[model samples]
Target: MPPMRKWTINGDFLTLSPNGVARYGREVTLAIDDLLAAGGPLADGLEVTLATPVGGHDLPLRHIRTVHVPEFRRPRLPQVWVQLQLPRHVQGGLLSFCNLAPVAVSRQIVCMHDAHTWLMPESYDRMFRLAHRVIMPVLGRRARAVATVSHHARRQLAALGVAREDRIAVAWNGCDHALRWRASRSPRDYRNRRPFVLCIGRNQPYKNMELIWAMAPALAARGVEVLVAGEAGGAGALRHGPNVVALGRISDDELAAAMEAALCFVFPTRIEGFGLPAAEAMARGCPVIASTADALMEVCGDAAIHVDPDDVNGWTAAVIRLLENPFERLAMVAAGRARARLFTWRGVAETWLGLMAAADGVPVQAPGGRGAASAAPIVAGA
Candidate 1:
């Protein structure tokens, strides 16, 4: 049997309250659940001692060694001193974990989700950019093994000079079960309402809502209403159309209903690590028209219509072409559903388990050792 390993997960995301901040909290949650679920010869003696940031819900009270780190703006450095407060093995050290925080122990695994701040600097604040530039690589290079969500991020990490190519693993994010469950449930009857293209996410510069709005009039001219969902901001430039409906901060049920009922799901993001909305829409059986960007292509694969987000006419043409062609729309919806099946938390969890095994020097078994066989397969766009 492989020796039982000890892991210390950095639960920074869990420490923050969900204050309408659309960040990557759920990813941490999924990772925890997956680690626990993937128990066996490798997982039996494996014990996880989570070092969470201060002031949040304490998770799995029995298995956690909660450490209070100051917020990102003010991080406490002496993590070993903090670990001394715990009753368990303080000097045992972390075998592997995610994030790039200062750990007293070595043999760590750090997963940087993406470098969205680097790509879309104007979307984030100055403090965030400064932190990303300074801290992320330090954590990345120091860790024993590094992981990221996409190939795009791997390339970005390489550019940042964090980890060697061989040490880096790509673990893709999963489609939310909320999306899948909602997709399975029948949408509330709203057929009488005008057919509309659905747009999700906050009205941020990176989201490229401005470009989507530019094509709205053309879509409306062809009798397609545009439903805009998510928070609004930045210069107060909200898209207004006779056929436009802005529904802000909807429940998952409503989002699934909207996806099912829409003419199609339209995402015009300029940059992304992984396009969750595109996958969510695809899983919920909706045809997606996404921006022709690295992350979007990685997520949507060939299951979506690629549109140049900056080109108004190209956006209008893609939306219009799908709007008129029922066959093409149906084909995309089917393809999307099939493609979405490839992504799941269970699969991701198993991959993580194997990585942990590899890090332990245990001969990892076949059918799962392949770094990304568990990942959502990338169907490259033409």
Candidate 2:
């Protein structure tokens, strides 16, 4: 029998607004919970608890326990809570899904999704960027292990001197959650009178929303509309034509509906840890015309029509091609669904379990039947 192992999950993400990182945390936690419930070699002698700050969302979990830690009123409540109070409640190994983790917890594994703060400084505020710059390196060096969403992210993290490449594991984000999004149940009618190419993201500079806005005129000339979703922070400054519709901050169902009705989902991100939005669109059966960014290429593979982020003409051409060719669209949808299947929450959870077991100095078989050593980084789907 394996020796008993106790691990605590840093559920700080539950308290924050739902984004890619928060979505990763939630989906991975649920996957881990499901795995624990279905006892196996991975679950043997393993105990997990989710520790969150007070007022975090209550997740319907079985087999794993949830504990709320009270926080002291501080300037940065979330950061202070995780750094000071959350560490005190950890039973053994701490698993933090989001980027930041307590530096004091030496026996912790943190999932630093990306080095975006350093890579794309313009997208983040000074304080947010500064905090990540200071904290990530500390956690990278101090934490027992580190996990990232993609090989591209792992490379970026290492190149930025955040962590050693050997210390970082790659666990790609799952796309199965998008499959659950009910397009038919969407509250808003996303089916615009004219066929639209859908784009989603905040107005962050690295998101490269400007490329889409630039191409809108050419696309609109072809009788197609450009639908921009998510927070339109600098909507006033956007140079889009009248055909560009800003659907600010939509729900998952609404996004699903938009994708289903759209000509193709366009993601022109300049950089990414893993392009979760493109992967999600693929899973939802929407053809993707994504950027040629390293992470996007890695995640989308040949499933998407890759275009340079700065190529306004190229993006416009791809959208038009998909709009004109029904056969090409159908082929892409099939290929995308197949590619999206490669990433799974259960697979990610298994990788996490393997990492935990190895961290505990226990020799265990990883998801692909490879032996996990304490010092070796485990890449999911490797």
Candidate with top TM-score is 2
State the lDDT at 182 in candidate 2: 92
lDDT of 1 by residue, 1-382 (tens): 7455766655544545432212333444455555566546545566666655566466544433556544433454333322333223332334333344554435666667777777778887887677666666776666667777677778877776766766777766667564535534444544567778888858568888787667768877888887877775323324355666667666677788888888889888887767778878888888898888877777677788887778788777877777788898899889888778776655555666666667777677632421232334322132
Q: List the pairs of residues colliding in candidate 2.
A: none
lDDT of 2: 0.85
What TM-score would you give candidate 2 relative to the actual structure? 0.93
Tens-digit lDDT string for candidate 2 (182-261): 98898888675679888885868999978877888898789888788887624652456878887878889889999988
TM-score of each: 0.80, 0.93
The alpha-carbon lDDT assigned to residue 244 of candidate 1 equals 67
Q: Residue 242, candidate 2: how far off, in angstroms?
A: 0.8
Q: lDDT (CA) for every model shown?
A: 0.65, 0.85
Which candidate tops lDDT? 2
Residue 135 lDDT, candidate 1, scale 0-100: 62
